[model samples]
Target: MSLDYTSHSHRPEPDELVPSRYALRIGEIDVLVISDGVLPLPTAMLAHNVDPAVRAAWLNDMFLPPDAFDWALNVVVARSGGQTILIDAGLGLDPDLNLPRAGQLVRRLEAAGIDLGSVTDVVLTHMHMDHIGGLLVDGVKDRLRPDLRIHVAAAEVEFWASPDFSHVSMPPGFPDALRSAAKRFVKEYRSQLRTFEEEHEVAPGVVVRRTGGHTPGHSVVRLASGGDRLTFAGDLVFAVGFDHPDWYNGFEHDPEESAQVRVRLLRELAANGELLVATHLPFPSIGRVALDGDVFRWVPTFWDY
Candidate 1:
């Protein structure tokens, strides 16, 4: 459906008009950046391999709050012709997880003129809770959109769904009930979910690019229309401290791979000068990468909201 940006009625409220939720035009395609809300994590959770003093000093230099960090959860909603493609369902409500802002995904979709049920395809960058939780609704026992075509990285789904890893590598203390919910959802909806490798076109102008690191099968997405290009750099690159491109979250399955992939992707993005959607970057998470000396920086885009 063609969106009329002039219609204020469809826009989010002033309070919800975060820099993270905005629309961009790439040739004939309209890309709406939606928020799944933000996650507030303690400093300890983020201070993985870095020394505390170094981390604190870096945080101070970046002018970040000394106490904690706010990681933004952004999902891409791209509309062109009759296709309404959603990339990465946000984290849904999980009281046990103390996540209140998660379920904001669906609401943000409506604010952007996308009816959840009308979403034809959902491209999951990974199967992590934060990326797939919003695929279902709170208290709903069925697939949120029974007919929605869900595409996932074949290796990712296999790793997560494999029974062998359930008792071994799966994180301890994971909410039992939520795990059961995930298993049931996967069992019933597995038929609607398809897996792809390397490169595949989900739609006319949207393509999937597999970039593993954070997860064995994690992938990023690339959208191109005319000469304009946009890449959703999944978890390959974290927005921890925009200046600290080498910093990797402790949760990354393979920090070295994650960092390597991130650096390579950043160089390509910087060279091509394409717009990027960073899931963890400070709101609206759309930006371009630039080289500053030997390091890179995230240069946010200005959206005419």
Candidate 2:
């Protein structure tokens, strides 16, 4: 058979805006998946072990941009036991940060009828800027919900708050400016910060589990109520990490530890069929992990218009 090689000049202009908020019901708890925006990271920064050609081929097979990878900033908002809880604050409102595509959490929250003051708690899954940046408003931190309690992993806080942290070399491809921003956030919330070690419940039905390696104190938020369960997997698996759990990203503080945690978490989620809410997955990033042979695969939940 012969194929037509003609091209059309009537391509539509790109639409950048997408429905950024999604409401999910997990038993008695109401969860909102709020999108700050998408970030385009260089693909070369993802897997350090894979050859350039193999990595490009892998990304190409998945129909992703071979040059840059699209990472979504999905924050979680949960209402349980009369408490409004925000999982991880999105990138803060800073135009100079070169993240103009992000920092939309506040606007999106208001659009969803979420009042910042009404949020009783803000959980920092890790000390990374993208996770805690939304805690600042107008380039200053005090303008945010000052009365709300901020939950952070003790290890994460100590690492970022250390005087030596600024002098240490950041992971490959990780921006140094983010370290400065993270320090500011830590100082701003230090008064209201409640650091937790090991597993503990931060809110009514929300439990924080220490899953370090991505950072010294990286954690995941687990929500369970009325037999329904959902996990907020913070940077545990991004893009192809599910299929290749050993693939180390340049952002990990401890690549080996990160891989171990990723593999362990993926196994548990895949076995139990619990909903996995990833921060850096595609927008509205709610899904289930399925065991594909010895590895795993992401099965995004059905989208409801």
Candidate 3:
């Protein structure tokens, strides 16, 4: 099948409070989550809990109605010392997908006052369609920033680039777009790609820690400099209530492994008193992890600014 470069069908209405941009100043680093837009999820996607009641209770507790699902994509951008870093580009223009918000990433970055050409690095937590889809533009032959050094997990590079996994399941209305995007990443951008092992430093004060389970190469970023710290948790925890360390989203490639990584990540987040920015969390998705004895909780920021 050929790739479908359609935009998402459901976009933010004119009056919608879409969070296109925000910034967190951590000493010298400025971290941002550029809004790519929102997505409507099938309510049944998370029906993986052992008990239907448990799942329903989670939904209710999270104030999510049982029959509907909605989510937003907030891709990360960090700027420090003249270097602009973007983590996980959003879905770009795709004709067949009919997704409304798919192609607004670059525009959102511009809204945030960032020039695509100034982006020095692109860090991909994993190669899921929504995460890596914006790595390339519609007809452009290279990344939004051709000179940027792209960093991805070694395992993710292998898994997503493997030709045998072309027919994996994607969300409805889109069939082979994810696989096509991955292939394009490998073919055209491979030379600019740098794969790293767990706990490796991709830059000064920017560490990539393997938090696999969402994907074999799934990871989280730890940004620490000058005694201040924050973590870009990626998809480790999806929404507000999944704050429990053991709460793993059902979309994980390996649910059990995802849960394990979540547990470790939440524990560390709680112990170190670090701020968190999750991709699938609420807009302006910056927060801090709190520990309640052995459990974990999320305290969203009043202002990431």
Candidate 4:
């Protein structure tokens, strides 16, 4: 059955009846997966490289809507070595794109007792607005620790200087909005940024490594402690990516390279048998990857309270 989604029905309320945040531990590191809500994007955004008929068939098999569906916005918080790190800030409020259901990161963080001022570091997988917009919210900077360090890839910051949208296939005004958000973030937080070449350890077991594909400097966070492993894959992997590893996401700047990155990462994860969490994956997105013949499979872990 096709789903009929309406903005009003999905609008955020003062009190949420559904789950918003999930708490999990990677050995010793304290990890919290918080929902920034969901973005109702067009189905075309999922696999722009595929034919409409094929994409629609896939969506039907998955039991999702034919037009648009809510893509979960996940943000991660971790504490290690006396440092509180915020990984990929959530989408901030008041977007002109009519995505009012999203941008719930700040509020949800507050509810989770995550004080902005206590954030010692911010690990960015990239400079995309969705991954960095929460920090751009009004007065968020003021609330954050003045000594807070924002870690990102040097290539990512440089690319946004004059971002190339010729390779992207986004909705109307999205290109401009993304550019604006990235520009504003760098301008306001330039001094606070800590650019790394390849990889850098943010905390004891938390490392951010540059993996260029989705963008010039798309990165992923690897948390290893006491033999436990979990990786926060920013945008390189998506729900549709498992069956259609070659499918090009509209938001990807280099779709060809992105497929390469997606395949490599998926193979590694599948072999290593590590837990995985991603920004756009389903909430709490805690799961493992399994090799299913030539394709891959998503094995979402059972919820642990």
What's each prediction's TM-score?
0.88, 0.89, 0.85, 0.95
Q: Which candidate leads the pack in lDDT? A: 4
Off by over 4 Å in 3: 1-17, 139-145, 163-175, 240-248
lDDT of 4 at 16: 84
Clashes of 2: 0
Model 3, 39-136: lDDT tens per residue? 66754455444466777787888789886676778787776656777888877766667778555787666554566777788888887777877766
lDDT by residue (1-305, candidate 4, tens digit) is 00111111233345787778777778888888889989999999999988999999999999999999999999988888888899999889754767888898898777676778888999999988899999998999999988999999999999999999988889898888989999999999999999999999999999999999999999999999999999999998899999999999999999999999999999999999999999999987899999999999999998764
Give the TM-score ranking, best first. 4, 2, 1, 3
In model 1, the Cα lDDT at residue 185 comes to 56
Put down candidate 2 lDDT per residue, 163-271, tens digits, no spaces: 2332223444356567777888877778989888978787678999888878889999999988899999888888788878888786787888889999999999998
Residue 99, candidate 3: how far off, in angstroms?
1.8
User: Which of candidates 1 and 2 is the stronger one according to lDDT?
Assistant: 2
Give candidate 4's error at residue 260 in angstroms.
0.3
Question: How well is each residue in 1-305 modelled by candidate 1, as lDDT tens digits?
Answer: 55556132354566764333667778777787777988876664454667788888877878888778788888888876677788988887767777776668876666665666678888988776777777666543252467778888787776666522221122344435435555755876698887897777888888887888777788989888999999998777776535666776755666667778888899999999999887777777778999989888889887564
Which ten residues in a row are the worst by lDDT in model 4? Answer: 1-10
Q: Write out the backbone clash pairs for model 2.
A: none
Residue 173, model 4: Cα distance from true site in angstroms: 0.5
> What is the Cα-based lDDT of residue 118 in candidate 3?
73
RMSD of 1: 3.3
- Pairs with backbone N, CA or C atoms under 3 Å apart (clashes), candidate 4: none
